[model samples]
Target: MDTRTVFLNACNEIANRLDGFKILEKGQRLKKSSLDKDIYFEIYFQSSFRNDSSSILILPHINIYSKILKKWQIEQIKNEYSQGLIFGNQIGYLTPYNNWKEWNLAGLSYEKSINEITENIQQYLFPIFEIFNSKETAIDFLKSNGTKFNQWSEDSISPLDFLLCFSENETAEAFLNNFVNHCPYKGNILKLYEKLKTQNEIDLNYSEFHGADKIKLAFIKGLKII
Candidate 1:
């Protein structure tokens, strides 16, 4: 089968597995929207040409909208862009599709490719939905699993970032505080540390420094100033 046929079949299988979700196919991209329309997962079949060969790759992107968090994000984006935030915050992850060349060179079959796509959805994509479905579920998931700070990225805020922004739950608060305390930075890191500890929301304006500062502040918060 051709790449397009295989890609569409894989998308159909994924949509079927998701039940109430709807899939919108636009050329080589398939967007999966949640039943309530508040969440979206974009799957892209990216084609690249190199040397004398061409290959198809898959990519996944997520957009989540929570009524509770939208206002804060809107205010932050307005303050940052002056045009306001038009879309919900979105994130993407590394997937097996990124390594399509390895599979293709290994003579991976179309059926096996579909199975790999399904496994990727189950292992990586669905967990994100489970964590972000609601503020309550998100907090519960964080409390139980702890914040996935290692997954922090500059492009988008993870579930842990969302919890830090809006959740006043004791578990969330303590986790942030503890995370800050255990960091390795010292001296000037206190300013950012105190800001994180005292602020109710992370300023999107400072997002460039957000990821680095989180690690630094976590380590330097309580150190004595020289």
Candidate 2:
């Protein structure tokens, strides 16, 4: 009935429906571990303020540590690469409390808010679990759909990020080289190319880059050329 209770109930419902996933960190998060145990799918809820109303931000993210690649190796790709990667375009859902304000004003039940939260998980987050059940599947999904580094950011990891983690130095270099030719951010791309030319390993400090700068930095970091 309260916001926290409603959110926890929705998380519980999702956990119950999905096999192998259990709630963690109190009722705020849920995770399903991989065979390696270090890698997993993590879903959590955070509170955000926007548009003059409190909103719930539901995030579904993965943490991948490949047997072939050490965690540090991948972290070199993106400084914030602790969480594996996010798959597909439906990153997360932002459900606003304002939507339920009308019903609450009339003293009606908040079933609509509860149902909305549940549906958000079902429609946007549950499918991610189905698609990325395994490391291989997760990588394959990225290869097929993660060409665009449009929303590259510290908080969001892209498919291209995963490819760098799994690819060899020569392969990663080639991919970045080709991507730079067509990518919109020529200055940043050239900078990365220059860095890759001399160094085998590079750290992409996101703060150094802005706007499209982040996208190129991610490619350079992900490859970890050295």
Candidate 3:
């Protein structure tokens, strides 16, 4: 049994049900822009064959984009927002639940797996996606939650990014320095701070940021107060 074919065929049926949805990544993903707002959603069924050939585990990875934020990111970086993959807050990681949904196509049959996954999309993901349809909501959530939104907190670099996103550069700089003061890998992460703490985006290493991380690059570069 071909797991990839099974996944793609199910994704095809899901795509047809959404009005403006487009199949992407050769049918591993679906993308749809909000009709009334500048937000967009992409739910990539990150699928892989299980040890048994007849089943696959799909982690429904979601992304929500704010076109306004993308514009700001691009205008600062002197490039298009993204000609490739767009990054949003990885809301899945923000939550505590396990995201993997298994489809035992051979055992469950195509009808059962497809309908169940579709229900997951509609009942689970849709309500979550609806809350983040604009930059206002995105910004509000980040600002309101502060450090709570990130599971790793100060141990991770996201706190600094979150601060920087809100233009709290002085606070971000202080936070990075404070984190480096306590980190075991101070030398390496401190080097990152040195590269990132500068007011000059031109002096920064462009080659280091790639793919989805380029969004981080744009956010860091857009900092006016750092």
Candidate 4:
């Protein structure tokens, strides 16, 4: 299968299986004129691009906890598995070579467009794949697991902080919205929470949240913060 074909097929599978999720894969050429000078394109062959050619499915909402709570969540997930944080669901990329290629091409004249697209695809799919290896099983697990908020005052910096530090404008906003809705500290612990809520700049739903463990693990993995 071709690279575009692989991404398309993977997106289709993810959409069909995962609930409340959407697929984002485009098999089109991005215009260089509209992009920054640092972006470029790369060729992908079906067989040789073993690690380079892959798919990811993101949960978007699985990373819905405050910074401090996220730290505790990581510890909890770690205790359950004998394997360290790098193994199992917390794994970041397909392999070492793939990650090396990504980092090497992150910001350059020949990496602007394709690299950006590749990065976005990776972000969207990996977490979803981890959470929902099997659609029914994932849904069932989410239902059984559920999301819960924990104290937000334990640590000064958190997973949310890390995501915000690295994420793009809109992505950071979405993550902050999730935190506003799911973080549990009250009164004075979280000054940011109060500011975000009172400002009403973000769309936060006051529903029963779930997946304390997954949310925490994801934040810990992505943020690289305890």
Candidate 5:
């Protein structure tokens, strides 16, 4: 079988075995949403092109999302610079078992790769989906999963966003007091923090907010935190 055929076949096999996920992007992506449709676990394929035209590595990536947050993000996109924070979910490869990310699916290895992928989804991802199945659990998870917040991080979920989205202004300010110190780009976080602490509102336009502020402001405005 050709490399492309092997990739598609493996994806199809996974779709057949997995119960809830719906096929997307013509089989390149798999999406499983929660019963309430508030949470989503997206499994997708990535190709690692090799120098040898014969070899292919079909890397599988899975990430979780909140249906509410997704919609909130769309509402908050006020300008060209403002962007969505898509990491309502995160995965280290198909599963995050010990932060594991290893994939090799080319030619005959497709069967083994598919098996491993299915097992990882069952073993690691399903449990996570259950954990963050609701916005309440998801907010609590981000608050507890302290990988240390970096205000400069582009894609990483900042707990502040959750706080702002959920209108936890008091807690968010306390967090910002310390978090801003860690972020060298503290201008935006601090400004937002001070506004919440004193005025209880954010007046900055989406364009005025830079970097991680995009997430913070989105939560504040979209969720109407004031």
Candidate 6:
């Protein structure tokens, strides 16, 4: 099945099983932080249970444009107030393809965070990965099925690029560090810090700061790249 078809089906199935669920538009505005003025199209689904507002599932989608349209898109992204949305926060996940390769997970707002949505898709999507055990196989799946992605320059890198094959402690540590360095919101930093700490005992490699005690993990979040 096509990845989009797979995704849409999974979402529709979820709506069918779960009461008060609704899938909204393909694009909508999302604000990352109060101080950060950039708006993102993260709210792709809205649920009546959540008061008819979107809880975005940020999947990767390739945007093709004519010369004039491309210029407009770049200009909009470059605005001083426009902060580029990072992975995990806004966009969720995608089926591995040459074109849309950065993310593959669905995201929920702080208000509508639900594991059921993320967990349900695993059963539907994981089997597709089983058929092709290699990275190339994954790419072939995307190239053949992902029409929008195929149009772009095939020079893009996949999520497998940064993922270290060896699951060493240092490898995980480095991954966490890079994640924090690129995060735009303090809330996410804290959430990831707690997640890391719960999963393993990691020393906070940062100095003290005011108001950090409230979050407890803030010290860890403030770690410098020393």
lDDT of each: 0.46, 0.47, 0.53, 0.30, 0.57, 0.31
Return the clash pairs for model 5, or none: none
Q: Single out the weakest 10-residue window by summed lDDT for candidate 2.
A: 98-107
Predicted structure 3, TM vs. truth: 0.55
Using lDDT as the measure, which candidate wins?
5
Cα lDDT of model 5 by residue, 1-226, tens digit: 6666667777788788988779987687998776677666777777654513356666667666665555555555444442323353334532434453555676566578789878876776676566656767655644544223222122242445445655465555444444444456667655664566565554445345444454355445433222
State candidate 6's TM-score: 0.21
Off by over 4 Å in 3: 1-5, 16-27, 48-53, 56-59, 67-71, 78-102, 109-112, 146-191, 194-226
What are the per-model C-alpha RMSD values against the true structure? Answer: 7.2, 6.9, 6.2, 18.2, 6.2, 19.3
Expressed as tens digits, the lDDT of each residue in 102-144 for candidate 2 is: 1120113335544555565565455555555565665554443
Q: Is 3 or 6 the stronger prediction by TM-score?
A: 3
lDDT of 4: 0.30
- Model 2 segments more than 4 A misplaced: 1-10, 17-19, 35-38, 48-70, 74-109, 147-161, 167-187, 195-202, 205-207, 210-226
Index of the highest-TM-score prediction: 5
Candidate 1 local accuracy as lDDT?
0.46
RMSD of 1: 7.2
Clashing pairs in 2: 62-84, 63-84, 77-221, 77-222, 200-225, 200-226, 201-226
True lDDT of residue 168, candidate 5: 66
Per-residue lDDT tens digits for candidate 3, residues 83-128, read 2222333324434433324555555666786676666567556654
Candidate 4 local lDDT, 1-226, one digit each (tens): 5444544443344344434333333411111110222211111211123333333222111122123323533454434322211111111232222232322111232234334434543554344344433333333433333211112111111333333333343443454344434446422223433344354333221211332333333333342211
Q: What lDDT is reached at residue 191 by model 5?
A: 63
TM-score of each: 0.55, 0.56, 0.55, 0.21, 0.64, 0.21
lDDT of 1 by residue, 17-85 (tens): 654455666434455554445544454444334312244444444455444345554553444323211
Clashes of each: 2, 7, 0, 14, 0, 6
Pick by lDDT: 2 or 6, better one: 2
Residue 9 lDDT in model 5? Answer: 71
